[model samples]
Target: MSFHKYIFHYRFSGKSDKPLILFLHGFMGNIHEFDEAISLLTDEFYCLNIDLPGHGKTKILDDDCYKMPKIADALINLLNELQIERCFLIGYSMGGRLALYLTLKFPQRFHKIILESASPGLITDRERLERVKRDEQIARKLARSVEKDDFRKFLDNWYNQQIFGNIKNHPHFEQMIENRLQNNPKKLAKSLQLMGTGVQPSLWDKLKENKKPILLLVGENDSKFVEINRKMFAVNQLCKLKIIKKAAHNIHLENTFIFIENIRNFF
Candidate 1:
């Protein structure tokens, strides 16, 4: 509960004898998101699902805690205090980006990695700057435009995105994201602008240089991320890609059985 003044909310299963599995949720998402999937896998491994800063029960940092590097460092600190020597790190989307960043930053602390629907940060410095500017604007807008239905509007825009654009009417998938989105819009927007992978340093080179085993899973309907995964897998020899059939960006929720089976097999 009190891992350094940072207050990280987490859930774990299994005894100390088994391997540890860390679950990192996506942007604007918290530990609750992985409950269903973690429930399916913890019988074999110790699961640690964390509530990242600015989301769920975790308290926001005093300064801007939106940067990926800062958040990753905080998590690393938590692991150190937990006395966890090594563990398998798994992340989805934003969580995936952080997991890879964490593994690359401290490779020895993690054994294997699972990244679902994640990508390396913005490719060029120009792209990074552009995203940063865009995020800043969103942050400003959130401060000035906070409204009761702002969260709903954010989801509307989120669902309109190309990756998730193809998914609709799928109650489970919709519910999963809705639960994540059912929070203060101001915080969500601020977190996205500040801690977003779009604003973080690009890690494609680090991914290629790292020798750890990595699994990249995404849905077949998510064309944008699928293309990125293909490129990442082709370039990174240690990377293995898995495409879930009939699923969208939120594969774990869209096809829970397949998501659980695939990740369980990987672990």
Candidate 2:
């Protein structure tokens, strides 16, 4: 309950009187991922970017901290420590999933929520099992890479996935890789084991229960998530879906200008 007990590294920017915008980065990403967006929106909102557990400067104390709900709890504690009663949230990919979980569990804490390329977890038990297996395989590979002290290969394979095809060729590609490489492989592997979509509880049934306005952003090129969000929108009229043109999984990075514009319009 007390967030001060956790040592999450965070950066708060902009005027205190402005509405707060909490930015959550995806896996293998740090708080700096939102630097560009934060810079543009600082005049209007106070941006609080935190490095999630197992990634960035935040160190994981217990293995259980990597679980989805626990991560959400930590965020709640963070808000308490920052004295933020309520704030807008923007999460990218893995962080978006976590954001959804948080909103589902603590709806009153958020004003508006934006999810980029996130899902509500696997629906059926069979689908969940399959996803768990796939995630386990990837986690094992990451663990092996960590043992060998070669996280670069893990990152290379991760970014090489078809979903991120649009990002690999971008000019910031090298810098992105470098930023991911800074993460501790062992913690990241543990994170995948605990917080992976396969292990997290499905929120499909809870979608209609969400009262706060939700914006679901997906890249046009990321067909998988686009379809997922489409289905999500169909089920929840409160949710709105926006497709980023020519962008893939990481829309904030792939098409930042449009991404910021979308956020501005949404807010």
lDDT of 1: 0.79
Sum up the clashes in candidate 2: 0
Writing each residue's lDDT as its tens digit, candidate 2 over 195-241 gives: 99899989999987888899999999888999999999998888999
Give residue 170's lDDT in candidate 1 (0 to 100). 74
Worst 10 residues of 1 by lDDT: 142-151
Tens digit of lDDT per residue, candidate 1, span 133-198? 877776766555466466556566667777874566676656766676655566767677767756
List per-prediction Cα lDDT, in the order shown: 0.79, 0.87
Find the 10 residues in a row with the least total lDDT in model 2.
1-10
Q: Root-mean-square deviation of each candidate, in angstroms?
A: 2.2, 1.7
